[model samples]
Target: MRAFAALLDALAFAPSPAVQVRLMADYLKRAPDFDRGWALAMLAGGFDTACVRPAALHALAAERVDAEFLRLSLDFVGDPVETAALIWPESGTEPCPPPLAEVAPALSSISRQAAPGLLARWFDRSDLPVRRALAQLAAGRRVPGVTPRLARTALAAAFSADLGAIEEAWHGQAPPYGHLFAWLEGRAPHPEAVAGFRPLMPVCPLDETALASLDPACCRVERQWSGMRVQLVAESGLHRLYSGSGDDVSRLFPEIVAAMEGLAGVFDGVLMAACGPDGPPYRPAPPEALARRLGRKTVPRRLVAEVPVFVRLFDMLFDGGEDIRPLPLRERRARLEARIANRTRLDLSPVLAFEAAEAQDAPLVLKPADAPYLPVGPPWRVRKAPPKTVRALLLAARPGGTGERGPDYSVALLRDGAPVAVGDAPCRLESVERDRLDRWVRAHVTGRYGPVRAVEPALVLEVAFETVRPAPRRKAGLALTRPEIVRILWDLPADAADSVDALNAPVSRPPTAGRASRSLPSGSR
Candidate 1:
C-alpha cells in the first residue's frame, strides 16, 4: 500500500512523460506480483466496485472535525475526498498498513454500511500520503497524468515486452491479472484468445504546405465524417464494439452488435447515427443525435429506434481470423468492399478522385494508398479549413480550479436579440490581459450563481472556433467547437457582436446521405 501510494504521488508530480514512464516502470519492476497486478488495474481505471460515495466521505469528515472547518477546507480544496483525507485525525502509535493484495479484495467486497469503519481503520494505520491515495481509490479516481495506455506502456517498459502484442492480449483479461503477469514473467503461455480491441491508428492534421507534395495517384481521398472513430470486432462468435480508446462499449449499441451477428472480422470505421431507414442514401446526423445514445447503461428500445447508428467501413484489419493489417491500403480496401457487399449496418467509405475531392468545399481525409495498417502512425491525414472567428459578448466569470490563478470567462452570442450563454473561452490570457479582465469582472458583478459570477455584458471578445454544431440541450440552441479567445474587444459595442444565427448559418444545410447503408433486425431493437 505504501509503495502504491508513493507511485501515485510520484506520478502526479512527474515533470515529463519520459520521467513518468521511468517512475512507473521502476515501481512495477519492484512491487510484488499480486500488488503489481492490482496497482496496474487501478491505474487502468479498474476496481470500480471498491468505492465509497463522496457524500459519505464528507459525512465522515464532519463527524471528526468541526462542521465550519470542514466546509472551509472543502471550499479551499475543491475535492471532498481530498479534504476528508487531509482533516482525518492521526493516531499516536500507527499500526503497520496492510499490503495492497490484502486491501484490494476486502474493499471490493465491503458493503456501504461497513465501508466507513474499514476506511477509519485504514486511515488510522496509514500516514498522510497513503491516506490520500487510499481515499482517492475509495472515491474511484486515478491520479492525474496516469491513463490506461500509459500504464500499459509502463508495464511493457518494465518487462521489455512488445507493447503491440500486450495491447492485443489485454482487453478481455480481468484483474488482478494473474495470467497476464504469468505470461509477462514467462511462467505460462499466452492467455486464451479473445476478440479484443486493437488500438486504432492515429490521424494527423494535413499541413496545407505539404498538400502539393502529395502524389495524386498514390493517395486516396474520403470525406471526413463527423462521428466517433471505433473498432468493431466480430470473431469466433464474439462480437464487441470498442471506442478508439479501447473501452468495451458493446452493450451501449445493441442494434449495431446484433447487426454484426454473423460477421467474423476486425473493422476500422466511423460510428454514426442517421435518420430514416438503415439503407441506400445515408443521411449523416449531427453529433448530438449520436450523443443521445452514448453513456447509458441500458439502451431503451425507444431510444435505440430514435437514434439508429451505422458504421462506415474505412479499412479491414482482419478478414476471417487472418491478420491482414500487413497488407497495403489498396488491398485492405478491396477486401473491405468485398466483405461488406450487400450488408446492412456496414458500408465502405467511398474513395473520391484527388481532383474531385480537392474541388469539394468540405473537410477531407487523405490516406496513403500503399501504407500498411500500423497501430500508431500518420498514414491518415485530415484537411479542414482554418477556424472561423466571431466577436462575442462576455457575460460571466467562473472560478477556476485549484491551481488556476485566473477566473474563466463565459461568452455569449445574441439569440432572439438577447444574450444567451454559449460556452467558455479556454484561451490562456497573458498576465496583463488577465489582470485587466479580473478587475473588470470584480467591478461589474450583477448576480451570483454558486461559484460563477454574472457580469455586465459590456465587453466584446474575439473568439475563433473550428466549427459550430446544433446543440439541442443548450439554451443557445447551438454550441461552438474548439473555441478560444483571440483577443479582447474593449472598444467594440456588445450589440455589435455576432448573433447565434451567424454561427448557425453553415450548419443549416439539410442532412444528406453519407456513404452508408444498413438495416437492423426487428429483434435487435
Candidate 2:
C-alpha cells in the first residue's frame, strides 16, 4: 500500500499523460493483486473495477491470462477491505466474490491499526471512480464487525475522502442524480429545503420509464418551459429572486416583484418572455410567439409593449400560512386559485386527459395530491399553456471599432404593419464590453441595422441576447420607448403619460416562455 501511494504521487506529478499511462501499465504488470487492478483501471479512463475486473475475469476464462497472473492481479487489486472498500468490486446482488469478502475483516483490522496518514495514503492511491463506487457500498451495507472497529468519527472521515474525487468529476456542481439519490437514501446529509422551491427529483430524460409510470391523475403535465427557473422570494417588503444556481436576479425582473407585491408567501416558476401590457407569466406563452423571444434578456419598448410578461402562476408550493407541497396537485391548485386575485398574473393551469398508453408518449400532468380525479381508465391529468409566436426585429446596425458589425435594427410582430411584438437578432461582437453599445443600437435605432431586414409577424426572429436592463435601477433604466407605448409598468417612459395608464396595465407571459423554462429546467442560470 505504501508503495502504491508513492506510485500515485509520482504519477500525479508526472509531466505528461503518456508518462502516467506508462507508469500505470508498468505497475499493472508487476505490482501485487490490489495495486495491479487499481493501476490498470487508472490507465483506463473509466475507473470502475466493474469494468477492469470483468475484463480480467474474461481473460482468465479464455485462458489468455494464467491462474498465477490472475491470483497476482487479485492480490495486487488486494482485498476491498484493505482499501477501505476502495475496490468495491461487485458481482451482482449476491455477496461479493468469496476471495474479496473473505479478506474484508483482515483488511478492516489492518486499517484500524494504521495511522491517519497511512489511511489517507491508501485512499489517495485507489482509483477515484472505484472509491466513489465503494463509498456507495459503505453507505448501503451495514457491516457490524467492520462498522464497530471503524468508530463513527473514523467512518465519517472515510466518507469525506470521496468528496475530492466526486468534486473533481463534477466540477463544483453536485453530482446531478447520484448525489441527490444518495441524500434521499440517507447516505449523505439531508437535503436543504428552501423556503420557496423544493429540490425536486426531476424526471430526467433518461427516466422515461419512471415518467411513464407516473399516475396521470396524481400529476399534471405541461410543456417543459425554457428560460431559467426563478424562486421569487418576497417576504415582508423585501423582494429578491434567485436563479436555480442561486444567483440573484433581484434587479432583472422588477415588474415581477411589483406584480407579486401583494401576494403572500414565496413561489417558484420560470422567468420567461411575457407580452401584452404587463410581464412574464409562470405558464408558457403561445408557442409561435415565444419562439421569437427565446434567449432574449433585453426586450425593447415595442416588443415589451407587444409581448410583455405576466406570471402564469401555474403550480403553487406555498401559500401565506400553509405548506401545500405535500398536498396533492389539485388541492394545492384549488387553494392557490382561491388566494390568487390577480387573474392577469396568476391563473390555474389546465389539465389534459390521457390513458396509460398515452402516458409514456405524453408527459404526466401533476395535480394536487388529494384529488379524487382519475384518468378515464388509466390515469389522466391536466396541463396548462399559452400560445407563442416568433418575430424578427430590424433595429439600427453599425460597424464596431474592431470592424465587426454592431446590431441596431429590429422588427416586431404586426397584424397590419403595426408593431405587435418586437425582438432583436443575434449579434456577434468582440465581447460583452461592446454589448452596451450594441444594446443602445438595438433599443434606440430607428432604421434597419446589419444583416437584419424588416419581416412580418409571420416571420419570427431567432435572437440571442443577455440581460441588459431587465430590471430597473434608475429613472433612465426605466425608459423603453417614447410616449406612444410603454411595455413594463415600473419602468414606464417619462414622456408616455397617455400610455402610462396602459403600461401599468397587467398582461400575461407568453406560453413559449413557459415551455422554454420547462425545456431548459433552469436553476439560477
Candidate 1 stretches greater than 4 Å from native: 10-23, 62-79, 182-192, 296-298, 376-378, 396-409, 428-454, 504-525
lDDT of 1: 0.80
Residue 333 C-alpha lDDT in model 2: 63
lDDT of each: 0.80, 0.38
Best by lDDT: 1
118-194 per-residue lDDT for model 2 (tens digits)? 32333344444434333222222222112111221121232343322222222112212244335423687644333
Tens-digit lDDT track of model 1 for 1-525: 999989988887776667788899999899988999888888876566455999999998888889999999999998888998999888878557778987777777888888878898888898888888888888777676667778888999999997877778888688889898899999998776499878677787787779889999999899988888889999889999988767778888887898888888999999988876758446767787998888677889998888888888889899998999889999999988888887777777889999999887667999899999996666588887566777788888887532333456788998777898777776455656777778888999999998898999888777767777777778997777767665676666678677888885533221132211121232231
Task: List where candidate 2 sits over 4 angstroms from the true fold.
Answer: 1-201, 206-215, 278-307, 355-525
TM-score of candidate 2 to 2 decimals:
0.32
RMSD of candidate 1 to the truth, in angstroms, is: 8.5
Worst lDDT run of 10 residues, candidate 2, spans 481-490
